[model samples]
Target chain A: AQSVTQPDIHITVSEGASLELRCNYSYGATPYLFWYVQSPGQGLQLLLKYFSGDTLVQGIKGFEAEFKRSQSSFNLRKPSVHWSDAAEYFCAVGAGPTGKLIFGQGTTLQVKP
Target chain B: IAGITQAPTSQILAAGRRMTLRCTQDMRHNAMYWYRQDLGLGLRLIHYSNTAGTTGKGEVPDGYSVSRANTDDFPLTLASAVPSQTSVYFCASSVGSSGANVLTFGAGSRLTVL
Candidate 1:
């Protein structure tokens, strides 16, 4: 069985400040990781994904995630966050080509002005 | 492009009533899924279909039923709605293999059984 953990239930960051959301996963084989964002009343949107290749992957809205194989972690990062970035972020892991994603509890990001 | 559209944005139903949530995808993807989102549980899969005519159970499929008669539609039905089943339901679909494919999600259907 595979699982994902986003330790922090909530995070607050000042506008223009750097932000990092931690995500850890448990999987036996090489895992496929993804970061998704859901704005108020909106659907989940893919921020970034890592299958295989360079460990560091960049995504939309200046978002990026580093896949540390040894740590079993794929944490999302942003150099600076905007007020509009206030949303819920989810970390998910897929077993294989099935695309069945196991999601983390989620992290609510609040951007303070 | 209209990725996925879920009907009845939100609904409140009485216990023991029957309900079917409709989901459609214009992308013509080969796979579709249904998930329920709670405050702290994130998203749990209820059912999924790899392709047309085939459906499979997911983590939490006890109270739900699904049908995949065609490529574009996958509807989830609750045999007997219960208060515990009240949660925001999401419909998603993917193309080809998921290793590199991103599953596009619908806005979601909020169901509340009273």
Candidate 2:
């Protein structure tokens, strides 16, 4: 079985400040990782995905994640966050092409002004 | 055209009553899935269909049943609604092989069992 863990349940960052959200997964094979953002009262939107390739993958809204194979971590980062970035973020992992996503509990990001 | 549409966007049902959450996708995807989102639990898969005629159970499938009669429709049924079943349900579909495709989701159906 595969599982994902987001260490922080909640995080607060001021506008224009850098941010990083930690994610770790347990999978036997090379994992396919994804980052999804869910705004209030809306369905989740795919931020980025890492199948196989470069260790650093860039996503929308200046978001990017580094896949560290040795550490089993794929952490999302942004140089600076905006007020609109306040939303719940989730890190998901799946094995092979089964495409069945196992999601983390989730991390609520609060962008303080 | 709606990429995916769910009927009765929100509903409140009495416990033990039967309810079906209708899901339709125009994308003609090969796989469809049903997931429930509860507070702090993220989204948990309840059932999935790899094709029109085959269905498989997911992580939480005990209280849910699903049918895929064709490529465009996959409806989830609750045999007996329970308070525990009161959560927002999302229907999603993906193209090609089950494990390799990106899922497109419907807006969602909010169910309340009282």
Candidate 3:
């Protein structure tokens, strides 16, 4: 079965610091990867996705993710984290032709002042 | 706006009661999906529809039912609500059934079965 794993459950970083959220996925063929962010009491928003192009993909709100096929990893990165960047992050892999997504357990980000 | 809209942002219901969470999209997406979000579980897909008249089961389809009668509407129905069904349900739609397409999600409906 295809699955996504986010090792870090929670992370705290000072405002303006760099951030990296780890993600790993297991699938049979070349996988379609994605990163999503959910603000408090709001719907999830797509951050970035890796389908077939460049390994490093840019997304909304200055977010970027690098998809590494060797390690089955798609890690999200931000150069400088803002206070407003505190939210839950999820990594998902599109499974098969039906467009079903297998999501990882979310990582809660806490931005400290 | 061209986005997904879900009705009854939040609802509380007694166990064994019938409930329906409504979802509609103006994007004219060809694919619609229902997923339940829980703490520590991220989001688990309950059902999906590839087009107007087709539906399919997903990872966690039990205890939930759905119908896609038209292009815009995909309502999820719980025949008999149970306490375990309390969750934040999200409705999402994509341009097509291809895995490469991005999914646009609604604000989600918080359901509480007491």
Predictions in order: chain A TM-score: 0.98, 0.97, 0.98
> Model 1: residues >4 Å from true position, as ranges?
B97-99
A best-first ranking of the candidates according to their lDDT comes to 3, 1, 2
- Of the candidates shown, which would achieve the greatest TM-score relative to the real structure? 3
Better of 2 and 3 by TM-score: 3
Cα lDDT of model 3 by residue, B1-97, tens digit: 7899998999999999999999999999999999999999999999999999999999999999999999999999999999999999999999889
Residue-by-residue lDDT tens digits, candidate 2, A67-91: 9999999999999999999999999
Give, for candidate 3 chain B, the lowest lDDT window spanning 10 residues.
B94-103
Q: Can you give the lDDT of residue B75 in candidate 3? A: 99
DockQ measured for candidate 1:
0.72
TM-score of each: 0.98, 0.95, 0.99
Where does candidate 2 clash, by residue pair?
A97-B99, A98-B99, A99-B99
What tens-digit string does per-residue lDDT give for candidate 1 at A56-102?
A: 99999999999999999999999999999999999999866677899
Clashing pairs in 3: none
Which 10 residues in a row give candidate 2 chain A its minimum summed lDDT? A93-102
Which of candidates 2 and 3 is the stronger one according to lDDT?
3
- lDDT tens digits, residues A5-27, model 3? 99999999999999999999999
Residue B13 displacement (Å), model 3 = 0.5
